[model samples]
Target: MKAWQLTGFGLDHLVLNDIPKPEPGPDEVLVRVSAVSLNYRDKLLCDGKYNPHLELPITQVADAVGEVVALGTGVTRFRPGDRVVTNYCTRWIDGQPTSKETLYSLGNTLPGALAEFLALTEDALAAAPAYLTDEEAAALPCAALTAWYALVEKGQLHAGQTVLIQGTGGVSLFGLQIAAALGATVIVTSSSDEKLARVKALGATHTINYSRTPNWENEALALTGKQGVDHILEVVGGKNLAQSIEALKPGGQISIIGILDGFDSTIALFSLIKKQAVLRGISVGPRRALEDMLRKFDELKLRPFIDSVYAFNDARAAYDRLEKGAFGKIVIRVRD
Candidate 1:
């Protein structure tokens, strides 16, 4: 079996080794990975920026979809040939995540998906949406689910509301589609006019080039006639939250999902307080939420936008593409 092992820090260290195939535990299943998607987190993991203390010799990537090759004797949920997708948070099954459940994340605390075979508990698997192809489904586990969790599960968003999305990445595009499908007005911000133009075709009501208009919050406010937006998918961490705060309506919610702009920020606490805004840190989502999102996607016939696909052997190239930024999800075809 061939698997990518992060033996040390950096892309130069992401070595593909001929490793022994893993056998399923009593309650696990062995999945023959068909497709996987690269996230910014995976790039950080490869560069040793995600977790400086992460153990080496572990498989990379977290979002994947595959067919079950074998099942543990005690695995009653699935059997051979059942197509399943990897749940980003492998242990968190339903409802609000517990401390222990949150700790057992895929590609971090547990073995990742960038391998030929992955032995996982049935609880870590979700029935792949029948409508989606393997590559598309592979994009759902983290990027899609995080947007779903923030807007649908936590924010309880509805029609007539406004959502300000930052950037044109995987989660951001998913947010645009989900919000549009639910009848919400979406305002998308990107540094590139080309990407912003693309989002308009994807149902974004308005687009702002942040490079041209650095005070994007003012543009957001103008779009809503000074009423402010009802929700914000704050993918850019750090002081960007302050801009998001400016665009948020009183009592609106901000789901912080990324840390691309460094970790620490000295925000004016008074602004957030005065707005009576709700700030929640989104860490992907639970398996049940993933299932819910799948159901909605099924009903809406929403196809995930995939920017490009790379062969398994070119996984390093996929990481490079991710680091350079992509308009949507970048997929890795795990099976040649």
Candidate 2:
């Protein structure tokens, strides 16, 4: 078996090496990976920005779509040849996240899915949406689930409501589609006009170029006729949070999902108090949510927008593409 290992704390230090093939335990399954999707967390893990103390030479991605080539004893939920998608938080099977669940995150504490073959506990896999390709299914574990958790599970997004999504990345795009599917109006923000136009075609009712209009929150306010949007997907952390609050309607919710703009920030407390806003920090989600999301994808015919694809041997290049920022998900084909 071949695996891309993070031998050290940098992309340049990653090595592709022959490794022993793994077999499942009594309650596990052996998966032949078809495709793996890159996330911003992959870059952080590679650059040692995620956890400087993380053990060396670990497999590098948490999200993948694969087929069950073999099953272990006691596994009854699936059979050989069943298509499955990896789970981001292996231990958070249902309900809310716990401290224990956070400790077992893939690509962090547990082994990840950057190899041609992976052995996972049957509980850590979900049946793939039959309508999606491997790459699209692979793209769901992290970004897509995060969006669903934020918009559907936590935010309680309703039809006729308005949602403000920041950037055109995987999570934002998923938020756009999910919000639209629920009949909510979507306002997407991006630095590029071309990207904004593209999102508009995908059901974004309005688009804002944050680079062109620094006070984009005011534009959001105006777009809602000064009532402000009903919900916000706050992916950018730090100082940008102030503007997100400014764009929210009274009693509106803000699902904080990313820290792309750096980790620290000083926010105006009075603004949130005045708006009576709700701020929730969201992790990817539980397996149950992933299952619900897959069912919804199938029912709504939702397809993930893939920005690019790379071959198996070119895995490092996939990481580079993620670092440079892609409009949507970047995937690596692990097998033909």
Candidate 3:
């Protein structure tokens, strides 16, 4: 089997090599990976920013779509020929998360999907949506699920509501599509006008070039006739939260998912108190949530927006594309 192993932190150390193929455990399944998706976290993992102490020589991705070649004993839910997608957090099943459930996150605490073959617990897999191609399904495990969790599960987003999504990244684009599908008006922000125009074609009711208008919050507020948006998918943390609060309607929800701007910031409590806004932090979400989102995808014919695809041999180039900034998910096709 071929896999990209990180013997040390940094893209320079990510080596593609042949290694012994893994066999399924008693409760696992061996999947022949067809496609794998890249997340911003994969870059962090490579640069030693995500976890400096992570063990070396580990496989490097969590989200993937594959065909089950063999099923281990006791795995009744899936069988040979099933096309499945992986759960980013292998142990998070349902409801409130526990530390134990989040311990073995793929590409971080355990070996991941950046290989021709992978053996995963039956619990960590879900039936891929029939409407999606392997590369599109590969994008669902993290970015799509995170958006679903934040908007649908946590925020209880509904029709007629207005939502503010932070950027043109994977999660935000998903947020735009999901919010629009649910009948919500979407306000999208980006640093690029061209990207803003692209998102508008995808159902964004309004778009703001945040770079041109640094106080994008005011633009959001004005767009809503000074009442502010009902929900905000706040990906940029740190000082950005202050502006997100400003863009929120009283009692509106803000699901915090990213810290791309910076990790820490001084937040003024007065804003939260004045607006009575809800700030909820989101991780990738549970397996059950993934299942629920997939059902929605199937019913609605929702397709993930794939910005680009690279062949398996071009894994490093895929990482470079992710690093540069992608309008949607970046994927690597492991096989035809």
Candidate 4:
């Protein structure tokens, strides 16, 4: 078997090598990976930015769509040939997360998905939405589920509400679609006018080019008739969170899901206090939320937008695309 391994701290060190594929063990399933999606985290890991101390020479990437080619004894939930999507959190099946559940995540502590074959505990897989292609399903584990968890599970987003989505990346695009399908008005912000126009066609009620209009939060406020948005998906961290605070309605919520801008932020506590705003830090989500999100997406016929696809051997190109910032999910097609 061939696996892309992060042998050292940088992309230069991410080399492909022949390795013995594992047969499934008790309660495990052997997956023949069809496709794997690139996330910003993949870039971070490759550059040694995610965790400087992360062990070397491991498979990289946490999201994949695959088929169960074989199952170990005691695996009762799935049979051979079932299409499956990998779970971001291997342990958190439902509800609140504890250290036990959160500690056992992929692309960090556990093995990753950037291989032709992977052995996973049956609990770490979910039924792929039958309507989606493998490449599309590959984006769901982290990108799609983060949006679903932040909006549906934590923010309690509902129809008739307004959501402010920052950027046109995978999570933001998923946020726009989910908010739109739920009948919520969505305002999307991007640095590029071209990207903003694309979001408008994808159901964004209003668009803001943050590069053109530095005070985009004020535009969001005006778009909502000064009432402000009911919810915000705050993917850009650092100083940008202040703008998000300014864009929120009183008693509204902001779900912080990324640190693209930087990790540190100096915020005015009084702003949140005065607005009675709720800020929630969101990890991807639990497996139950993944199941619920897939069911909803299936019913609504939601399809993930793929920005680009690279062949299996060209996996590094997919990471390059992720680093350059793609409009939607970048996928690596594992099967020729």
Candidate 5:
């Protein structure tokens, strides 16, 4: 089977090569990967920025959609032809995250989805939504699930609540759609007016072109008549935290999910104190959360926004596009 391996710990270490196809163990299933999606974490892994360094010669990318080709003994949840998507966090099968569950993530501590065939525990796989193509399904496990956990599980987003998403990246876009599906009014922010306009058409009721209007927190406050939004999906870590803090109403929540803009930030202590705001950090999510998200996708017929698809052989090129900050999810087709 053809797979892309990280020969060492840097971007220059990645190389494509042929390796023996994997066989499933007694409790595992062998899946023929159909498509793999790129996330910001993939870029960090390539750049050697992820903590708990990945092992060399390992495949990259945690999120993928595949077809089960062989099921090992005791694997009863899946069959040979079932279309499946594996959870990024393989160990968190149920309940809150534990040290054990956090230790065995796919593509980090174990083998990943960037290969033609991957062997996984049956517990790590979920049936793909019937409405999604392989490329679209591939995009869900990380970014989509993060959004669902941030807004649905943590925020408890209700209909008619207002949501503010910091950027138009994969997770933020998923946040927009999910919030919209739940009947929340979504406000999107982007440095580019063009991108903001595009997101508006996708159900954002309002957009703040952060480049043109630098004080976007004021704009958000004005848009809500000084009450501010009910929730915020914050991606920019250091530079935008103060503004995000000011853009929330009393008791509103902000899910600090990414550090696209650097890790440190200056915050207004008074705003947090006065608003009684909740700021929570989110990892991808658990297997049960993935299941709930798939159910919602199926119920709403939600289609992931795919920016582009590259062939498996061009996996590095896909990473290049993600590093350039392309809109939506970038995918690699592993099979036809």
Candidate 6:
């Protein structure tokens, strides 16, 4: 089998080499990986930015789609030839996140999908949406599920509500599409006018060129006729927090999902108090949430926007492109 191992804690240490295929545990399944997707977290892991350092020589991608090649004893839900996707939070098989569940995650604390063959528990896997290609299914477990958890699960978004997505990154783009499918109007922002135009084509009712208008919260406010949006999917944390607070309608929700700019930020307490706004932080969601998200994807016929596809051998180049803030999800075809 071929695998890319993170030999050490830096980008320079990723080594592609041959390794023996893994055998499944009694309750596990061996999947022949079809595709793996890159997220911003992959870049941070390569650069040694995650809080808990990953063990050396571990495989590194949390989101993937594969076909089951063999099943170990005690596994019943899945069988050989079943197409499946693993949840990013592989240990959180039931209930909300706990200290125990948080301890083990694919790609970081455990071996991940960047290999020809990988073993995963049956509890952590879901049937991949039949409408999506393997490359598209590979992109959903992390970013798409995070957006679904924030908007649909925690935020309790209604059909007539308006959603404001801060950027065109994977999570925000999924937010745009899901909000639209739920009958909500979507407002999108991007640093590039060209990117903003692309987002508009994908069902964004309004687009803001943040590069030209630095005060995008004001633009958001004006777009909503001074009432502000019902929900704001905030990715940039530090500098943008105050603006996100200002761009919410009274009692509106803001899901803090990323810190692309930086984590530390100054907040205006009075503004949040005045509007009675709710701020929620999200990690990648649980397995049941992933299942629900896949159901929605199938029902809505949602297609993920893939920016580029790299052969499995070009995984390093895929990480480099993700680091450059590419417009959509970067995919690595693992099998075909």
lDDT: worst 10-residue window of model 6: 94-103
lDDT of each: 0.90, 0.91, 0.92, 0.91, 0.90, 0.90
lDDT of 1: 0.90
Better lDDT candidate (1, 2):
2
lDDT of 6 by residue, 1-336 (tens): 899888887777888978889999999999999999988888888888873467788888888999999999999999899999988887787676765664577878888899999899998899998889999999999999999999998899889999999999999999998999999989998888889889888899999988898999999999999999999999999989899999999999999998988979899999999999999988878898889889989988999989999999998899888878777799999987
lDDT, candidate 2, 1-336, per-residue tens: 998888888889888888899999998999999999998888888888888889877887899999999988999988999999989999889986676775687778887898989999999999998889999999999999999999999888889999999998889999999999999999999999999999998899999999989999999999999999999999999888889999999999999988989898778999999999999888889999999999989999999999999999999888888888898999999999
Instruction: After superposing candidate 3 on the true structure, give the runs of residues whose Cα lies further than 4 Å from its correct spot.
Output: none
User: Which consecutive 10 residues in model 1 have the weakest lDDT in total?
Assistant: 97-106
Model 3 C-alpha lDDT per residue in residues 234-335, reported as the tens digit of each score: 888989999999899999999999999898867779988999989888888999999999999899999989999999999999999988999899999999
Q: Which portions of model 6 miss their true places by more than 4 Å?
A: none
lDDT of 2 at 157: 88
lDDT of 2 at 155: 85
lDDT, candidate 4, 1-336, per-residue tens: 988889998788988888899899999999999999988888888788877888877888899999999999899989999999988889889979775764576777777888989999999999999999998999888999999999999989999999999999999999999999999999999999999889999899999999989999999999999999999999999999998999999999999998988998878899989999999899889999999999999999999999999999998888888878899999999896
Clashing pairs for predicted structure model 5, backbone only: none
Which TM-score value belongs to model 2? 0.98
Give the best candidate by lDDT.
Answer: 3
Could you tell me the TM-score of candidate 1?
Answer: 0.98
Give the TM-scores of the predictions, in the order they appear.
Answer: 0.98, 0.98, 0.98, 0.98, 0.97, 0.97
Q: Residue by residue across 8-74, what tens digits does model 1's lDDT show? A: 8888898888888999989999999999998888887778877888877888889999999998878
lDDT of 6 at 20: 88
Alpha-carbon runs more than 4 Å astray in model 1: 100-102
